[model samples]
Target: MLNRVIEQFRLKVSSIDEVEDSHSSTVYKCNLSNGENVFLKIPFTKLKYQRELEAYEILKGSVPIPEMIDYWSGDEECPGAFLLSELKGNSLSTKAKPTIAFQVGVLQAKMHSIRPPAEKALSGIKNEFPNWSHFVEEQFYSFAEDVRDILDEHLYNKAIETFKRMKQELPSAVGPSFVHMDFRPANIIVDEEKVSGVIDFESVRFGSTEIDFTKLYRDFLSYDDSLYIAYQEGYNSIRPLIDLENVLPFYRFTDAFNSIGWCKRRGIENNALFLKENVVRLKKWLL
Candidate 1:
């Protein structure tokens, strides 16, 4: 397959190494004969390929992200692949300093500020929901069904009640916006204490900006008040920060709930720790 990619793209490569952290895609770091470094990514599904490709088209100039150099929209024999310019950096660590958090916040705000493409221009992007709240509700119901057998009876009932409460009490979304549904430290790249780029946009979709903050908070902001404050400041510099005090708990709870369902789908054996953690969180929050 690599040889086929090389032949089809007419790429002159010096070296190629598989990137171990890629979960949803088979990724390779390739150093070209001309000394330019690039990444070759073959997404697991056509939907994922379309989402990432459309996300690049939307974010190219506005966000700090890798350049999409070349692509193959795959035929029956192979899945789609993208050759992307390497953004020189390391994945942002969970323990990164406040400065990087601030940059991440700014970049996130920039992403949210990008208006969705016109209705006719949506093409393959996943923007089917009428609104952000609708999207969240759909996510909860879908995942809830998936994990019905896995969750304890009492916990499942409590989760359904909590979802009802959230639906009734949560405020309307601030506005329609582009959300990076999987924003987290691992997807954020840092170079010399600054955010170099963000990657892994296969989960990108149209939703409220507030929905984007949950994972970042789970992984980074919850660890340090200073980082949270810095991130808020940076985001507010670009656009007004949402009132997290009221909305965060609901989003955070749903995030934990969805994670358990995700673990079930992906196999609890491989995600045992993650599954245990989220179950504990659900119990803590709901029971």
Candidate 2:
């Protein structure tokens, strides 16, 4: 495997180390003979690979991201992979100061404000619904039956009722925009104080910008109220802040709901419990 990759690049292989297996892909850190460290992303599924490739092509020059070295469409002998220049930085910590979160929030706002090129926008499965209400309603019911068994019956039933009631209560549609879908510190690379690059475009799509904030609020802002204030302040600086009173809870619930299923599938007991707790937290916010 190493020899094939090295020969393709006409470079000697110094080392190849597994980084981490994320939900979408298995990542590897490869050091070339010339002292360059590159990342190799082998997607777990073909659809994810296609989305990541298309996203990189479309998002080129529009945002900060790792430079694409090469993309390989694996045949029967090899699995598809992406070779990219490593972003020289570290992911921001959840404990980062409010100011840092504010900066990230600004970048996120800028991303959401971009009008994706029409030809390159639909990178994933077309999720067409008649209206935003229907979309929210579908997401509200996305909790699979098997996953529901993992939750306390009371909590699960309450969640259903709340969602059923709120489906008709969402704010008016603000129209489709470029959404990072998974924007968070983990996907953001920070070099010292400035953001050097953002990674992971498999989830990029056209959607409500409010949906993009779901993870940001759950992972970061929920820990510190000040971060929420700073993020809102930063975002409002670029675009007018939407009145998220009615819609925020919906997206928050969906994020928690989806995360719960993901953890359950991976057999992460503790993480599943944490996400279940978040479901409760979101339920409270729904009021």
Question: What is candidate 2's CA lDDT for residue 226?
Answer: 86
- TM-scores of the candidates are 0.93, 0.85
User: Candidate 2: misplaced stretches above 4 Å?
Assistant: 1-11, 76-79, 119-131, 268-287
TM-score of 1: 0.93
For candidate 1, which ten residues in a row score worst on lDDT?
Answer: 120-129
lDDT value, residue 89 of candidate 1: 87
lDDT of 2 by residue, 160-221 (tens): 77666766677666646667777877788877767776898776666677677777776777
- The residue-by-residue lDDT of candidate 1 on 129-167, one tens digit each, is 466677788899899987787887888998999988976
